[model samples]
Target: MTKNVMVLVDEQHRLDSVTAAVEACGVRVQRVMRGMRTIVGAVSDDAAIERVQQMDGVASVREEKSFAVPPNHRDIPQ
Candidate 1:
């Protein structure tokens, strides 16, 4: 099974170091949202997520999972 991890990091520090580490672990980093200073990546093991968070300048880490929403939701409507 694949694990999806989201990390909230410190923008002051360039994510290059963390990125390099994650890449070295053979995980695919899909997107890095600059605005939120967050990164989205996928790994085969949850331990990879822990390693990513342990990298310098990481504020927090969260796992992605299933969620439910109202079918007729009108919040943030376009």
Candidate 2:
């Protein structure tokens, strides 16, 4: 299963090198936030996610969470 994740680059490291390393680990990088040292990306499976987590320049890897709003019904609780 594919997983969406938020990756934070370590302050001591360069984003470019880390990004290349992450892709080598199987992350399909979708976006790069140089200012924040964050990268939003996806991996093919849990193993790939694990690989990304163990990389040298990665400060953190958090799976993306999804939430949905309540249906359009007056009876629903607020």
Q: Give the top-scoring candidate (lDDT).
A: 2
Model 2 has an lDDT value of 0.90
Off by over 4 Å in 1: 71-78
Candidate 1 lDDT, tens digit per residue, 1-78?
A: 888877777766777676666666656789988778777888888777777767787788778768766566677443
Q: Tell me the tens digit of each residue's lDDT in model 2 across 42-67.
A: 98788887888899988999898898
Candidate of highest TM-score: 2
Candidate 1 is scored at a TM of: 0.71
lDDT of each: 0.75, 0.90
